[model samples]
Target: MPTIPGSRTLSGRVLIIFVAFLIAALALVGRLAYLQLIKAPEYASMAESSRTVNVTIPAKRGTIYDRNGNVLATSVDATTIYCDPTMVDDPREMADALAECLGGKSDDYLALITQDTTFVYVKRKADVNKAESLKEKGLSGLYFLPDSRRVYPYGSSAGQIVGASNIDDVGITGLELYYDDILSGVPGKMVYEQSATGIPIPNATVVERDAADGQDIIISIDIDMQIYMEERLSQGVADMGGSDGTAVLMDAATGEIYAIASTPYFNPGDLSEVEDGATSIKAITSGLEPGSIFKTVSATAILENGKMTPDTEVFCPAYLAVDEYYIEDMHERGDMTMTFRDIIRDSSNVGISLSVDEYLGYDKLYDKILEYGLHSATGVDYPGEEVGFLSDYSEWSMTQAYNISFGQGITCTPLQMTRFYGALRNDGVAVTPHFLVSLPQSGETPEYETEQIIQNTEAVPTMVDMLQTVVEEGTGVDAQMEGFTVVGKTGTAEFALETGGYSTTMSNRDFVGFLPNSTSSLVCYVGVDHVPVTGAVTPIFRDIMTFAVDQYRIAEQ
Candidate 1:
């Protein structure tokens, strides 16, 4: 085969080799042209992205303050410690030290760094001092990540109302949750390079947009008033042998809710010790069977119809007949004639029921209750508000009319009951109850605009006088204050059990009143379970109201 190489066969072989080489070169050129034309832009774009950098910057959340500009909720800088698993040396010492310093730690802190994991969070919400100390201690593989934590100065003081934020600084409850969108400020971001240590390059091209902070919210709530109400209600609930209760203070004229609180409540600052069920605003959001308090409406109906006055007489025999039902009063009295004032002062069940039946028939009684804002949501500023419980008029059972007369059948929230009484206090001018004075615009409507629900301009002197008698001469003397007069109503509604009749263990007790004439100044409602309704709460109402008058500088009594 080698001998023929110099012959024509060798020449032919060389020619064939040359032609194949030329064809291969042409094929390579054509492949390069196809790639350059079709996929050039795509590869160039990917290459550019690999060289570019992106970064994110946190927006500063808005500062929450009280009326006097005291900080309520705030954000403070914190350093989060993270460990690289492949760098730690002493497992036992690190675990013991972390468990002792950070608290609630039961795992090995150093062994975590000995594993294949790249990152491990050791502690959150640590300050510069703590992070510096940890760094100085020289536990390898540990690094600090910047973070922020929410702080509440007042402790558990206004926890439920001022509200708590989520882990990400978003509002979770109370006012925090209510104004979340406004409270959370605009977020800013940055685009830059990162080193192998995962730190951003200093003085690099950082795309920083200054974040806009959240606006200040001025609420109608008074911090001192809330403290006072909490103290008083806490004591009252304990003394009354009740597990939980609530008290609310409001302006009778403006429909401003001043102090609203519920027991078994929690402090937002320290939610760790708080039970799950202890943090709701039950005073406004929960409903209860309002007892004799409902009688005020019936008695008001009697007076409004000119069928009775404070001194108008009704013969009391302790029982009244309504259709097929025989309604009995708690107190069985002889056929003794008593004034309408006497009926209210005594909180007689039969008297009110008969009064409601006689003065205005079933239809009118229903109409007046609806007018007084019962069985309806007041559309208050607070969240989770529920419309009161009242079987519709058309669904009135045999015992419904009489039962509702003494506050047994119908149920209402503390807010609903207070708003109803607020109507009477406002001289029958129904207004929406509110905690905030103003709010940022949502869609087209401004936040918490005040509006009158019903306007009955004339002051019903008879209703005023009767409520006055309730405080000065009736069950509300326990509620009196120094240098002030209060008109109030009390309710002790019986609760039905799963068994039968009613349970003595659970009763919805209430005491509501306002200063001087109900159409003005201050008003409060105390909703206590298993507690006797007394006039003693009148002083609480008076003291808080008078203080509010001075604080807000309202018209002096």
Candidate 2:
């Protein structure tokens, strides 16, 4: 071909343009093939993540029932509101709408809706009505899922024992925490694909797994008795002008707790109203120095050792001096002769101290304490059960020995004291205190083993007689009932101060006893803390015992 002037140059330019286009086209084809073949799985995954959602389906929590089949705790149907943040069109408006319906600061909701994620929880286990209210507003990107809320029917009744769960229905305290795994069943899940606007596409790939419901629990608590005990305890604490109180009623023979109550109890349904120490079951958790009531254990040890008889006489001074400590009787009295029986009936600190020092000895008394399970937890079925503190007998000084004889220089929970007394009233056999009656789901019955804590069965009767004398004509006289033979001991412990001395203005007063002649007698313990008087707790015991006797017909039995 003949080229004109500048034609050759134009042809060269055209050729250069063609070569550049060919190279660019080849690069484009290579890039497309590389992406479609080698990088296909990675891109596919990214696309799948944007459109697919995995939703958790919560399993229904179980119900808690009392011995009488009263519902103490249960779960109700609720809804959880979630959203696809990527699908949200106007996050500010949606956040304001959510705050209006669900009760929160709009800023907080706004933060959640503006998150850079496919999905996020707006509210978990919210009230169905509230969730529905928000849904009615037709907010885009919002979704609802089924959930459950834990509820307590009786409110503060048995609140500490029954415990409570969190917003996620996870148990966090008391029996609920103790039996969480069994109460919180396995959760299910749903996997599905959604559109850009977060709606499930028709015939989309969906997979689901079923949830397993939690097992129901039936505890040994008697709701009626629990309510009655709580009422009496609250009234008693108020009447005594005390800071707080705790009480327990148990079958003397079986150690099956019928009613356990603590004053200033918290409402499980509303934890916001709870005060410090209100959620603790003081009967099993708090350790306090039990005063004259511990004399019963000393008396039992003295008699069991075969070293002292009920008629054995000891001279009691007004006060016994040991190591710069003068242990005086609750009441001032001149030196007098007292029998073992008299020492207990009068709650004579000096006499019991002499008896323990002269007869029971430190090692034997400590041995007896251990034998009665005073050094360990009662093996209660509830959570957070604390045992009494007792330094080894080898660590005791002479003054400490005498102090312990009359319920000082040592500490124990009210439940431990009740269990010890129960052994005395239960023919020297102590049964493990328990709240679990049966697991109906597994058809399982828990074993409550009995131990011969007081080996001298014959000595127990004498101990019982001495306790009866306490109610008849002694410090525990207020615990006496007109046709009932009451056997109990009274305690007045000085509250220890953090400043290395006992509080002069406050004391823990308690009464523990049982009806001896009644069948299936209940060993009851009532304690009031921060009381000014030594005998403020006995009347509470009297009132509760009277009701129990009449309700259970203990006298007739």
Task: State each model's CA lDDT, in order.
Answer: 0.70, 0.87
> In candidate 2, which residue pairs clash?
none
Stretches of candidate 2 exceeding 4 Å from the true structure: 1-47, 104-108, 196-199, 203-207
Global fold similarity of model 1 (TM-score): 0.83
Mark the regions of model 1 whose C-alpha exceeds 4 Å error after superposition.
Answer: 1-57, 83-107, 111-120, 135-141, 188-212, 305-307, 321-326, 438-455, 498-501, 517-520, 532-556
Per-residue alpha-carbon lDDT of model 2 for 1-557, expressed as tens digits? 77588988999999999999999999999999999999999999989888888988888988888988899999999999899888788999999999999898999999988888878999998999999999999987898888888999999899999988887778988888888988899988877799877776778755488789898888878888888899999998888888999999998787788899887788889988788887869888889899889999999988888889878999988887899889898778999999888889888989998998898788999988998888898899888888978988888988889889989888999899999999888899988998878778888887888899998898899889988888898788888888888889998888788889888888889889998887656899999989876446888888888888777777634
Q: What local lDDT score does residue 171 receive in model 2, on the 0 to 100 scale?
A: 90
- As a whole number from 0 to 100, the lDDT of residue 148 in candidate 1 is 67
lDDT, residue 382, model 1: 65
Question: Which candidate tops lDDT?
Answer: 2
lDDT for each residue of candidate 1 in 1-557, tens digit (9 for 90 to 100): 46654688888999999999999999999899878987788887676455445433445466666655567777788776766554566766667666665665546554554567555777766776777776777765565656667788877777888888866677888888887777777756655543455444467655667556666566677777778778877877776666677788777677777788888778887767887656668877888788888887777766667766677788777576667767776556766777788989888887777777777777777887777777777877666787767777899875787788788877778887787677776666666777666533332333443434344333255677788788777777776655556678877778777788787555666788777632245668887775543323444455556666666655525
Top candidate, metric TM-score = 2
TM-score per candidate:
0.83, 0.90
* Candidate 2 global CA lDDT score: 0.87
